[model samples]
Target: MNGGVVTDERLQPDYEADDSSINNFEKSVSLKDLEGGAGQLPEQVHTHHGANGEATVYGDFEKDKEQDVEDLPTTTRVVTAQDWSSPDDPENPQNWSMLLRAYHTVPPALFGFTVTFGSSVYTPATHQITERFHVSSTAALLGLSLYVVGLAFGPVLAAPLSEIHGRNIVYKASLPIMMLFTLGAGFSQNFGSLLICRFFAGFFGSAVLAVGAGTNADLFPPRLRAIATSLFLLAPFAGPSLGPFVGGFAAQYKGWRWTQWCILFISIPVYLTCLPMRETYKKIILKRRAKRLGIAPPNGPAGLAAIKILAPYHFTISQVGLTFLAIGLGVAISTASAIITDRTLYQKRHRQALAEGRQHAAPEHRLYAAMMGSFGLPIGLFWFAWTADNGVHWAVPVIAAIPFAWGNLSLFISTALYLVDVYGSLNGASAVAANGILRYSFGAAFPLFTIQMYEKLGTGWATSLLGFISVLMLPIPWVLFRWGPQIRAESHYPTMIS
Candidate 1:
């Protein structure tokens, strides 16, 4: 039986019965009688006799009575549901006005920008930091590297918490904590204090990164999610790119301390942005509505269910591990000739399908940008290195950085969309959490060893090494594009949309 279609076997008349009383029973059983009341089953049963002196009975008396009850009309069930009162219910996030939706997106992006901007903003001040603390270059770099390490772990904890509480509350709680720690780092009296403070700032700041994608899913449907995702991704990539450029000037004139101060200053607006971000988690909203209406919740309080907690962790871990393998293999195999293209290309494909009357676009379509990005990454890295090696204009390598940044951004957004589309809003936060932890761990570790790699291998060879690795990873997006349907079909998790 299809979902929500109820069949009333108890009220269904049996033609084989010869008893005149059965006819009377059948007349009494109307559609209303079949659905007498919630959880009320028909007590009347019709009996039939066999010529061999055998008797058989029907009407919710079989061993599989529970299964039969499930097939009953939803109107006759004792289950509680928490859904929009009407299709146009204004409380449903999907029905929010365009202005309100835009309001929801920008604040998360700003929050992401301020936190990630701090990761690279202080790079230009590393020398000043070394001199002030009398520490080696490696030790001074820890200020930057450890912040990324904090980013990796922060989401692991925060995303899960968001699943329990709500996206708005997590933002309200985390932003201030991040701001305070950023201040601590700026005013630190010693090197140890600075590192400790920077790490804490990163940990708290990561809540936005951990949960922002999930927030987007809460607000937008699959069709519009692409644009929202592309915009949201800009912060993580653009902020890091712009930070060093801006910090270079600040480091030259205002000094190393100003870098931290600048981020803290910008944090003011980011914090204010959180004020209007209402609770967007569907379960929480439904629970609140249920309380107001004096009714039981549809699925009960979220995050307390065993499957909700465990399944998200399992799917998240699996996806992250697969991504890790792809990165490792790509690096180990070849990283060359990659270029970062606009992610809008994939969204364009989706819109095209919709225009052609296809309401459900293929999940693998999101991988289009990812495939292009895989190639772009190595090309940018190789270009930057070779240009730097030949002593070309400094601006040449700087311009070359664009492709690498673009490729990274495209890949991140594509994979993120894939996770959300496959796992849905409820579990998407956990998936993003796992991805952030692993990605940032690598982000953190790379800087720590980057200087050493360049010095020992020379810039050209070092960049070539990464280029070769990128070449190896080229197959990841390709394979997913080819086998995505089958892979998703095998998963225990449900896909929200194709």
Candidate 2:
């Protein structure tokens, strides 16, 4: 037996483990359930100390005494999960220094940025694609739409996979494949091949869509998560906005195919940089800990923007990409505003919670940023709708995107932080997975109908329609803020919030 750790490798456990050395050695009946990587880990795997003090490995999941997997068979195989050498072990992610944590944190964010960048990066080339492929504009738009829809569906499986495999392996496995498909799209001779490649690229590339928040949870505690989360999230929020900008120039100067080529060039560096990241999931570490005594580890765990040009603007397609920068600029402003709000509002309440001897402030307290920024979407939409005309200077319409971008970032951060606060890491992956499905689904659907809406309803009315939709949905966070505790209690998620 390897280091007194028994193997159920190939679905058979070695009960030869010495009971004496395994003093109080433990686990549930699910050991064999992990045979083909199927089953949940028993609670109370193990924990030592937090960065500050005693920390339970899986948040507040109190362990329950249960039937040992060994007992289910014949002789019992006792295992001491020697996961960490000590409570304050540097290997434990929570104990990592700020620099070390940042090292692990950035790759996922960059990789995510690349994927979102890919989402709309090709949009600037829609005209080029239509001409080359002999397709209509709507069909050309499907390259973007299919990719987003692909992203929406991937979280169904990716989140659970991350929960099982840990975040690093998922990224490693998916990013290269994503890059490969992207390259495939670039080389495709036909529209069918190109669209298929785009969908798979987004599908394989979707790991970050669901796992990023869980990674954030793995590295930083709630108090410090806001700033790090804001920064990490900025890459994604900025991606779609910036994609057209980059793709426009690339397509204009080089060709439509260069849009995909540029993505491959960008993604290679991101993937290569991610190759060395350490695992952050505690269950996986604890599984290895049980493995040192012997065993397995635990289980796991978009976009748009691309509007076209008209007469007064006299903007080229590539310049159209530049105009989309207004949205990116909005994204940047929103991120800055989020960081400021975190310090002024969220952190202040955090300090207050600590003073009250509580571990977390209310999840609803996270809503202030969302509440404040909610106006951006509709306001920007209406502003763009009405002002993006031959009558007004193009800059006026462009300026409208700033508030819209701000509102998007604010709401996104608020939702993410709130969910992370409510669910912690393990379950947070699944929670965020559900969120990803809905989020990307919407991301996918928007581009498909947006142009149609712009055409049928007229840009003014169509854009105003979206604005009105945003206005209607604005009460959601307020309702959550008002009744979140009661809803949270009824839902029965193991929240970290007080």
Candidate 3:
């Protein structure tokens, strides 16, 4: 036996290992200890895209050298990672037609739409809810604030699951649960029931927001991700903004309950539409391949173990904390400018910078508009606060919100893209999870005190308080933009690769 390994009658199929396999091996095995698969013998590792689009890597650790001759199988063929029976494997999502990928992507966006819309749809109905149950405003707002909190934590659990099991199952399982609780909220007889239902609804609905980004990564590689990411990112903010607008009108006309009912009506069709979505996680795709070839799946503990596989990815505390602070400032300031039309102005500036070759220049160049947003956010907030009096035309304050909202959205999208770019695709969901918790938690607490702050201090000073805080955090994006490379160079986080 060569190198203490027994020769088998069969041999591994010929297939070129894809790039992902090399990366997986590098992540899992130390360069000094190249023996594959968890302390087993030097083994053959096969890396390939799994059935559902997840990156799946498998290693055959049970070489015949370790066992008695009688214990070994008499006949076997080592299936290559790309053993798809043919080149254009119908089972491989990477090989799917673009039309099919679009079909898969739309459903997650719609799911994101419905859940995010639900987060604030009941916000305008707060007065009705308070009146119906004889509750105080703070108590009434639990319905909204708690949902925001759910949106924050849901990703902590859901993102890891998508990384493990694939995206479709999370959608299928979580959507129905979210729908059920939403319906319960609609029909609840008391404030307590409504509060409980809304919180759980947010909990379940959050799966789409948490997992959809990963699914997008699964469908579109880095070069093609920008448009899809824009659409996906817009849904979360757009839903909250639109929810209040629709719920305000609907609550005034059809009553508060109709707000919940309308969400259910829209959500049902979206749920049904997503049922046929093919699984997009590559690990799952490869696992299916193993099953077809009569090979055992990878040797590891399942469930939580699957998530632990991603633990090697690391980011600096500066990246997490600074991004969180920046996002919180943007969210708080954007609340004032929800309906502002001028939000696109800075985006136009950002686009101009890109046209001027900033895109090819450096990743930090993407933050030009974000830097502008820092100045504009405080301006918008102070303007909206000071001018938001009954004596003034409503349009004045509304106009003020434009710059603030524009700045907030621009900064947020840029920061998000920056994090995703630096962290790389495999770690994107986890990277987002770190910042999302802070942002959503802040978002939840901000509204609970918004009306109280406005009423107590008047709109001018109340908004000024928020604007002042925005000023404190204003230097974050700018500093990061100017010296980001230096910070990244010194930090433990992965550097951006072109």
Candidate 4:
């Protein structure tokens, strides 16, 4: 062991470790203390992605030379970290052909599509649901709120499962269960049954939503990541944007029950893809190989809106659903620009970092176009709010939603990338989980009062109130961008090369 840390020099294969990428080895993970399965992880860690897209992981723990070894069965061996057999190992997800990597990426993204789709599709059916059950319109919205709240907390559980078992298992396990819940929702005879089914559907469906990106990271290395992620991110965005539009048509042509059926029917293909899916996590793959060899190694790894104000402008159920296309327009623009940004700005920074003799680029590079969203989120809200009048053209307020969505999409993507860069894979999900809870919980709780807020305060003030709240949170990204290093240095969380 070098510097009180374990090193797999014997396992280093053809790849050379970029010494610059290695951080303090003694302060990262304590392998002796970690278990065979999912190990306890520190709150934060610094990871430097090397030129080849592989990370050079370093951890601090003295070798347990005195531990018994001879007494173990021949089928068992001391477990240590495993490395790829070679730089070009076909088994490594990072080394998979670009087309193959993308195929893997798309399925999970589509699974995410099903999730957000289910979330918003229910919105257009609210009126029918309220009437059918003799419940207030406010009560019908619980379907949306509870589903989102599940989206929030479901990750708390699923992220760790992905760490322990790999993403495919979670995806495979959650989808059918989610579908079952959706079926229960479609067939529910009572309001309580519908609400219950919606919550459970969201809880199960969120498995893919939570860990799909981790699958992306497993497949794509740093250079191709942004572009791939942009495409992958499009699924969820497109789902929510298109959901109401489609649901509106479904509700019009069929009934509210058809909305639930639509989600299930569309998701069938995503479920089919999982039958051929391969595991992407390298650690889990190595663990499987070790199980065969008996080597004990440790290491584990929206919506809302459109309603009261748009009634006069796009009054028909189908028209209101058509209004959701405005959000789709915004998502499409952001996604296209995101692709361009990936090809140009992201690549430029990647190349520059390599040339400057640094293995990794600063996470702040992601925040450039994203900041306008922070300041402009409120602008978009107010623009749509004030302009949403009876005489004003419906298209005007609809156009306003474009910027709101642009800001929303850019900020979320940028922030997520920042988290992965800052915390790395090991702890990034936890960081994201902490934030997602508040995000989705409020998402759920807000709708409970949103209609009331809009009806009582008028659409202008109600929307403006959301804008105002967004303004209060505006300083968050800036603070992190400006003072991140200092904050990280001072924080209790430890840093690792991992």
Flag the better candidate by TM-score, 2 or 3.
Answer: 3
- Where does model 3 exceed 4 Å of error? 1-78, 81-89, 300-498
Name the lDDT value of residue 79 in candidate 3: 37
The TM-score obtained by model 3 is 0.49
The alpha-carbon lDDT assigned to residue 371 of candidate 4 equals: 66
Candidate RMSDs in order: 21.9, 23.4, 20.9, 24.8
Report the C-alpha displacement of residue 339, candidate 4, in angstroms.
44
Overlapping backbone residue pairs in candidate 3 total: 16
Candidate 4 least-lDDT 10 residues: 71-80
lDDT by residue (tens digit), candidate 3, 1-498 = 122221221213234466654433322322122222234343555544444322333334343555554443333222333334334555666568999988888887788778878866776677788899997543555576556645654664566566567778999999899989999999999876886688678878888876676677777778987777667666665565567668878888998998899799889999999889989877677676555443455543233213222222222323322323433344444432321312354345447768987553355655665676788889988987777644565456556655775576556545554665566544543454455445644543343344446557865687799899999999988898778878778767676643
| Count of backbone collisions within predicted model 1 | 18
The candidate maximizing lDDT is: 2
Off by over 4 Å in 2: 1-86, 295-498
Model 4: per-residue lDDT, tens digit, 1-498? 222332333223333435542322324322222222233232222333333323333332333365333332222112333676456655688887878887898788788778888887786787799899997543565576557645754664566557657778998899999999999999999998997798789878987766776687788888878787667666776666677778879987999999999998998987998778899987788677545433455532101233453336546435655665666566556545554665677668879999999776677665654665676577788898788854688789888878876677656656655655677545553444444434534443343355457668887788889888888988877886677677777756653221
Per-residue error (Å), model 2, residue 282:
0.7
- Model 4's alpha-carbon lDDT is 0.65
Q: Using alpha carbons, what is the TM-score of model 1?
A: 0.49
